[model samples]
Target chain A: MIQFSNYDIISNLLFATQWTILLSLAAFIGGTSVALLLTAMRLTRNPAMQTVVRIYVELFQGTPLLMQMFLCFFGLSMLGYEISAWSAAILSLTCFTSAFLVEIWRGCIDTLPKGQWEACRCLGLSFLQTLRHIILPQAIRVATAPTVGFSVQVIKGTALASVIGFVELTKVGTMLNNATFEPFKVFTLVALIYFALCYPLSLYSKHLEKKFNVSR
Target chain B: MSLVNLHQVHKYYGDLHVLKGIDLDIKAGEVVSIIGKSGSGKSTLLRCINGLEEYQQGGITVDGNEVTTEDIQVRRLALSVGMIFQNFNLFPHMTVGENIMLAPTIVLKKSKAEAEEIARAMLLKVGLEEKFDSYPEKLSGGQQQRVAIARALAMSPKVLLCDEITSALDPELVGEVLKVLEQLAKEGMTLVLVTHEMNFARDVGSKVVFMHQGKVWEEGDSKTLLSDPQTDELKQFIGAVL
Candidate 1:
C-alpha cells in the first residue's frame, strides 16, 4: 500500500478543486453565450424558431442532468462516435445550465412592463437596438442575483461529472478514499471544498436579491 | 399638406372591433384633442396614427409616409410622428438626457455630442435642464411626464401624438403637464392629444374630436363644439365628465 501524507492528500484535493472551478467557469460562459442566442430566438416573431427553441429548452430542462451526462459520455460511444469525458461533461452541462438560465432570464425580462417595448418601438428602434440599448440593460440588473444564485448550481452540478470519469474534485475524492480507506476523512474534505466554493455565492446572491429589490 | 390622414381606418382587437371605420385628418400646425370614455378607442386611434397599433382595414398616412406594422414602414413613420403615453414611458435605465438622446443617437444616427446637445435643448424646452442627469425613477409623476415630452420632442417629429398624457398624473401634477401641452400648442407643434382636460382642450386645443364606440361622434372647433355639445352623446359625455 502506498502511503500518503496529509500534505499530499490536501495538495491533490486542491489541484482537483482547480479543475472543478475551471469546469464551472467554462460551463457558465458557454452556457450564457448559448442562452443569449436562444433568448433572442425565443423572442423572435418566427413561430417555428420559437417552437424549436421552446422544445430545446424543454428537452434539456425536462430531463435529469445525470442522465444527460451519461448520454453525452457513454451513449455517444455506444453509437460509435468518439468523445472524451471532459467534452461530454462540458457539452451536457452547458445545455443543462442554459436550459435553466434562459428561463431565468426570460422571467427577468418579462418583469418589465410591455410599455417599455412599446416605447422603444415608437422611438424607431429596431428590435435588436431596443434589446441592446434599453431592454437588456434593465433586465440584466434584475437578472444579476438570480444569475449568481444559478452559478452555485453549476458549481455543485460539476460534481456529477465525476461519475463520467472526469477527474474533478469529487472523482479525485472517491479515488483518494479508495486508496486511503477513509471515507469519513476524504469525502468530508470533498464536501467541505464544495461548501467553500458555493457558500459565498449563495450569500452574495441573497445580498444582491435584497439590494436590487430594495433599490428598484 | 395634411400631416396625418386617416381614411376609413378600421381596427380590431381579436373578434371585438376597437376602431370602427374611423375617418379623420390632422393638418400640420394644428392641435387636435381626442376625448371620450374608456373603450371608446380614442387611445387606439392615437396609437394607430403612430403605427403602434395595426388596423385591420383602411390606410393612414403621416407626412407622406404610410403607417404599417412593417419594421421599415414604422421606422419611417417614426421620423414624422412622436407619441407620449399616459404612464410616461421614459426609459428608467437612462438619465433624463440619455432618455432624450437614445432615439436620435440610434435611429437618427446622430453623433453622441450632437445628440446630447439636442437632448439638452429639449430638456430646456421642457424646463428640466437642471434634471438632465436625473433618472426617471427619481422624478415625480409630473417631472417624468415632462421628461417623456422632452424625449419625444428630441426626435423633432413633425407631429406629436399624446394619449391621455395627463390621466396618470395626480390632480395637482395634471396642471403642470397640461401647462406644458398648452405651451406646445401655442407654439403650433401639430399636437394630437387624447385628453380629458375639457378646459385645456377648449382653451388651448384648436379642435376637439369626441370619439364614441370607436367612431368620431362629433368634432369641430374646440371652443365652440365643447361648449355647444352638438350631439346628445357629446352632451352626455360633457355632462358626465363635468
Candidate 2:
C-alpha cells in the first residue's frame, strides 16, 4: 500500500481545483452564449421555433445532469467515436447550465409590463431594436441577481464531472481517500474548497438583489 | 387638409369587437378629446391610430399616408403620431434625458449632440428641464407623465395621442399633467387624448368624441356636446362622470 502524507493529499486536491475552475468558466461562458440564442428563439413570433426551443429546454432540465454526462461520455463512445472526457464534461454541463439560464432570463423578460412593448413599438422601434433598447435593459436589471446566484450552482456542478473521470477536485479527493484510507480528512477538504469558491458568489448575488431593489 | 383620418375603422379582439365602423377626422392643430366609461373602447381607438393595435377593417390615414401592418409604413406613421399612456411607461432604467433622446437618436439617427439638444428643448416645453438626470422611479406620478410627454414630443410628431395620461395620477397630481396638456393645446399641437377630466375637455378640446360600446356615440364641439346631448347615453355618461 502506498501511504499518502497530509501535505500530499491537500496539495493534489488544490491542483485539481484548477481544473474545476477552468471547467466551470468554460461551461458558464459557453452556456450563456447558447442561452441567449435559446431565449431569442423562444421569444420569436414563430410557433415552431418556440416549440423547438421549449423542447430543448425541457429535455435538458427534466433529465439529471449525471445522466446527461453519461450519455455524452459513454453513449458517444459506444457509437464508435473517440471522445475526450473534457469535451464530454463540458458539453453536458453547458447544456445543463443553458437550460436553467434560459428559463431564468425569460422570466425576467416576462416581468416587464406589456405596455413597454406597445410604447416602444409606437416609437417606431422594430422588434430587435425594441429588445435591445428597451426590453433587455430592464430585463438585465431584474435578471442580474438570479443569474449571479445560478453561477454558484454551476461551480458546484463541476464536481459531477469527476464521475466522468475528469480529474477535478472531487475525483482527486476520492483518489486521496483510497490511498490514505482517510475519508473524513479528504472529503472535508473537498467540501471546504467548494465552499470557498461558492460563498463569495452567493454573497455577491444577495448584494446585487439589495442594490437593484433599492434602486427600484 | 385633415392630418388624421379614420374611415370605417373596425377592430376586434377575437370575437369581441372593440372598434366598430368609426369615422373621424382631425385637421392640424386640433385638440380632440375622447371620453367614456371604462371599457368604452376609448383607449383602443388611440392605440389603433398609432398601429399599436391593428384594426380589422378600413383604413387609417395619418399625414396623408395609410396605416398598414407593413413595417415601413407603420414606422413612417409612427414618425408623425406620438403616443402617451396612462401608466406613463417611461423606461424606468433610463434617465429622463435618455428616455427623451432614445427614439430621436436611434430611429431618427440624430447625432448625440442633436438628440440631447432636442431632449432639452422638449423637456423645457413640458416644464421638466431640471429632471434631465432623474430616473422615472425618482419622480412623482405627474412629473413622470410630463417626462413621457416630453419623450413623445422629442420626435416632433405632428399629432400626439394620449390615452388617459392623467387617469393614473393622484388627485393633486392630475392637475399638473392636465396643465401640461393644456399648454400643448395652446401651442397648437394637434392632440388626440382619452381623458376623464370633463372640465379640461370642455375648456381646451376643439372637438370632444364620446365613445360607447365600441362606437362613436356622439361627437361635436366640446361646448355644444357638453351643454346639449343628442343621445340618452351621452346624457347619462355626462351625468355620471361629472
Candidate 3:
C-alpha cells in the first residue's frame, strides 16, 4: 500500500485551483459575446442570416464537449498546427457554452408582448432602436437568473478540459491520486471544491428566479 | 389638399375580403368617428391609414405620403399618422415619460432635455403629469390609455388614429379617457376614431362613418346619419345598439 502525506496532497491541489477558475471565466466571457451576436442574427428578418445562425447553434449543441475538445486538440494537430491544451479547452468550451446562451437569450427576447413592437413602430423608432431602447431592457430582467444558473454549469464543465491534458481541478485531483493511490479521498476533495465554487452561484440564481418570477 | 385620403381601396386577409372599394377623404382639423359592430373592418380601416396594414388595390395617402408600399417610405408615412390601439399598447417596460419621448428623440432627433419637456407637457395635457415616472403596468387601464394618447400626440402628428381606444377600460374609467380625447378634439387636432360609444359618436363628431360588412354603409353629418338613416343597414346597426 502506498501512503501519502495530507500536506503534500493539499498543497498541490490548492495550487492548481486557479487554472480551473481562469478557464471558467474565459469560457463565460467569450461565450457571452458570441451568444449575443448569434442572438441578433437569429432574430434578423433575412432568411439566409437566420439559417447561418441556426446551423451554428445546432452544430455545437449536438456534439459532446469531450469529442469537441479531442477534435480541436488532436484533429487540428493532424492539419499541421500545434495548439496548446489551454487553447483547445477554451475553443471547445466557448463553442459549447455559446450555443446554450443564444437559445436562452432568444427565449427571453421572444417573451416580450407583441404590443411592444407595435408601440415602437407607431413611434417610428427603427428596428435597432426598438431593440436597444425597448426590447433588450425588458429582456435583461428575464435573462438574468437563467444566465447565472448556466454559469454554474460552465464552472463544472471546466472539468472536461482535463481529458485534453489541461491542468485544471480534475487533472490535479487525478495527479494527486496517482501519487497517493487514494482514489476515493482525492475525488471527494474534487467534489467539495466544485461545490464550493458552484453553490453560491446556484443559490444566487434561485434567489433571482424567485424575485423576478420571469416565467410568467 | 385633404389631410387624409383613401381611394378605391381593397384589402384581403387571405380568402376573407375586409375592405372593398372604399373611398374617403378628410380635411385638416376634422373629427370623424367610425361606428360599427366587431369585425366590420372598422379597425382594419384605421390600421390601413397608418400603414399598419396593406391594401391589395388602390392606395391610402396621409399627409400627402403614400402608404401602400413596403419600403421605409411607408414607415415615413406612418410617422405623420400616429395610432393608438384598443389595448393602449403602451410599452410596459418604459416609464410613461419614456414612452411618450421615444419617437421624438429617435425619429425627430429632439434632444433629451427637449423631448422630456415636450413629453411632460403632453402628459400634463392628458392629466397624467403626476405619473410621468410610473410604468404602464403600474397605471390603471384608463391611465395607460391616456398615456398612449399622449405618446401619439407627442409626435405632433398631422393626423391621429384611435382604434377602440376606450373599449378596454372599466365603465367608470371610460369617461376620463374620453374626456381627454374630447379635449384633443376641442384643441382642433385632426382625429380619426373607430368607436363603439354611440352617444359620444353622436355628440363629439362633426362627421360619422357607419361601416358594415367591410363597406361604408352610411356617412354624413352625425345628426342626420343617426336621426335619419338613409340605409336599412345603418338603421339596423343603430337599432341594435339603441
Among the numbered candidates, top DockQ falls to 1
Q: What TM-score against the true fold does each predicted structure earn?
A: 0.97, 0.95, 0.92
Global lDDT of each model?
0.92, 0.92, 0.88
The per-residue C-alpha lDDT of model 2 at residue A109 equals: 97
Candidate 2: what lDDT?
Answer: 0.92
Q: What are the per-model C-alpha RMSD values against the true structure? A: 1.4, 1.7, 2.5
How would you encode candidate 1's per-residue C-alpha lDDT over A26-78 as one tens digit per residue? 99998999999999998877999899889999999999999999999999999
Candidate 3 similarity to native, TM-score: 0.92
Q: Which pairs of residues collide in model 1?
A: none
Interface RMSD values, listed in order for every candidate: 0.8, 1.0, 1.6
**All candidates: DockQ:** 0.78, 0.68, 0.54
Model 1 misplacement above 4 A: none
Which candidate, 2 or 3, would have the higher lDDT against the true structure? Answer: 2
TM-score of chain B of 3: 0.97
Residue A195, model 2: lDDT of 98
Query: What would the per-residue lDDT of candidate 1 be over residues B36-113, giving only the tens digit for each residue?
Result: 999999988998888888899999988877889888888888887888998988888888988999999999999999
Worst 10 residues of 3 chain B by lDDT: B69-78
Clashes (N, CA, C under 3 Å) per candidate: 0, 0, 0
Model 2, span B1-242: residue lDDT tens: 89999999999999998899999999999999999888989998888888777899998999988887666777888799999999989888889999999999999999999999999998988888999999898999999999999999988899999998888889999988888889999999999999988999999999999999999999999999999999999999999988
Query: Model 2 off-target regions past 4 Å?
Result: B69-71
Residue B182's lDDT in candidate 1: 80
